[model samples]
Target: MASIANKVYLFDRDKNLQWTSSIDNLEDVAISADGNKIIAVASNKVYSLLVDAPEEKFHFPVGYPDAEWYEHESPNGQGWMTYNPEPPCYGYHLGDDWNAKPPPDYDDYGDPVYAVASGMVVYAKTVPGDVWWGNVIMIRHDNINGTGVITSMYAHLRDINVSEGNVVGSGQVIGTIGKGYDDKLPSHLHFEIRYGDSETVGIGCIDSELVSGEQGPQGQIDPTWFINTY
Candidate 1:
């Protein structure tokens, strides 16, 4: 049981004080339904800390601790940015097609794909040509500002380094870029984050836009806002 002024404390099932932190203007305590992370929402920002990890901290899946990539915009008419490089449009297509792409070598073959955070590999599959996202990997995060059972998914890979039920550390290389398609759709990583029992697989994934209120909570989060992409 450790805490400081304006701090939030987390307890384990055994009633042990697992983790705690001090925050300014600590607001309501939000617990993940899985009880893996505890979020402390302050006045201006949010704090996400892992519960089981005593010495390790959560990190961005890409571009941190010596990793970088050229962030691309959705040219296929997904103008609205999302964690997933490719946006699966929902309802009807309003603008142009959703299969947008960047210039050549934007995402080359064998481009390294990384695990967004340290978590257990709940789902992993490698089936090239079976679907647009030839290979898919879903990782359930330990905690993100107390967001419970949040998941990060990587798709359209040519190779998969990890398998199901494997425990991976943050920033660990799990796969590589596969054929992202022709010039219309370059080889890039299709990534996304989900909360709760949301659909990790990108099977016809057409999520609604920001604050559009058209889609459910399956994954309304913008990955760019959650991670340190810049």
Candidate 2:
């Protein structure tokens, strides 16, 4: 089976067109009885049809950073990450790390942090501890042409300009970079995207798995993947 232009087409293994269904906006689906019936998902509504096996929708074009920002602190090869635990904190780290540290430039403190895409601000607050993300912002994007729901988070912020339930536009300045109470750390933005509600630590949030060793938010997607480049 395949989908095109909001329609689902069923094909036999022999490449023959078995049937077709006119779907308005397919969000998800499930099938049963050895491809005899299918449950088509269209947001709040679900439909049941005969003759089909379950199929998952592909997320195409993915999502690029719709926000306007200065620059990436760490590039591809010159980055650090914890996603891969070989050495732990492997790669370049989850955040694109725009305007990052090492030089401790005080002027960088108020550097503006922009929303990578248009969405509702779901969270913003301060978390305790210099290790955990101190100041943070989380935004939940509504359905994008049935592309599935996702969330974006900005951490280690110094200032938050948006509140919960606030709809923010792509490239809008939601806050400034801050290091929270970590006096030893320079102000830099730690950002990431999650598959769902994910998780947050009231004052802010943290991926326990990334820190300790328990299962954490479904996982963290590299923020660089969403960044738009000219």
Candidate 3:
């Protein structure tokens, strides 16, 4: 498999083209040893498809059944988001800080963090001496209806249930929410949706640099928009 000019091409042993991906901005491509599956990475997402079937889906990283969770919208209101990308505290918030509603502060601690989609765990480890990220897990999901690949990152986790290279199913519990390294800051899940590279564990946020206009930093997208759209 090879990706060039935003296209992915699959060829048989004879080098004859067997299939061409309809998606664009594909940065890399790989095939399983058995040649039964193909995984491709785009500028802001990743996609994998079976040789015989092609489909993808996504889910919320927190909450169960109905995903009864909400993002931190304001510092004055209940739940997380004391600092955001918007005014007041104009920090370069790259992702959404998810929190369970009602009776905030440590109430949601240790809550299970789920895999938003079926994919391989590309990165999972606790950052040593880093109080902002704590435990982080990144899952790379294949193309969503031919829209390229997407990665889901869960941070500030209390416990990591899944390891790197594990293929997890959508909604599978991968970890539990927690405060940072030394339990600094209030308990909440700092979640992000990154594209392109799946192995890089980016700084949760930055004070400078905007990747997508004023939306977010480079390689990151709005977690709320991604969850609702996909």
Tens digit per residue, CA lDDT, model 1, 52-143: 63433345443443334445455445333343334444432211111223474353567666666566676788644453556778876654
Clashes of each: 5, 19, 7
> How much lDDT does each candidate structure score?
0.53, 0.53, 0.69
lDDT of 2 at 222: 48
- TM-scores for all candidates? 0.56, 0.52, 0.68
Colliding pairs, model 1: 39-146, 48-145, 76-100, 88-206, 158-178
Error of 1 at 37 (Å): 15
TM-score of candidate 2 to 2 decimals: 0.52
Clashing pairs in 3: 44-195, 45-149, 46-149, 46-150, 47-142, 47-143, 48-142
Error of 1 at 203 (Å): 3.5
Per-residue lDDT over 1-230 for candidate 2, one digit per residue giving the tens place of the 0 to 100 score: 67677677777889899888887766544433234444455543445544343332212111123333334533344332323223223322444455533453434676777765555667877765546577788876544325356677777788889886565555567888776556334555666666566446432224332443222344455445433311
Show model 1 residue runs off by greater than 4 Å. 1-60, 63-67, 76-107, 127-130, 180-185, 198-217, 228-230
Q: For candidate 2, which ten residues in a row score worst on lDDT?
A: 56-65
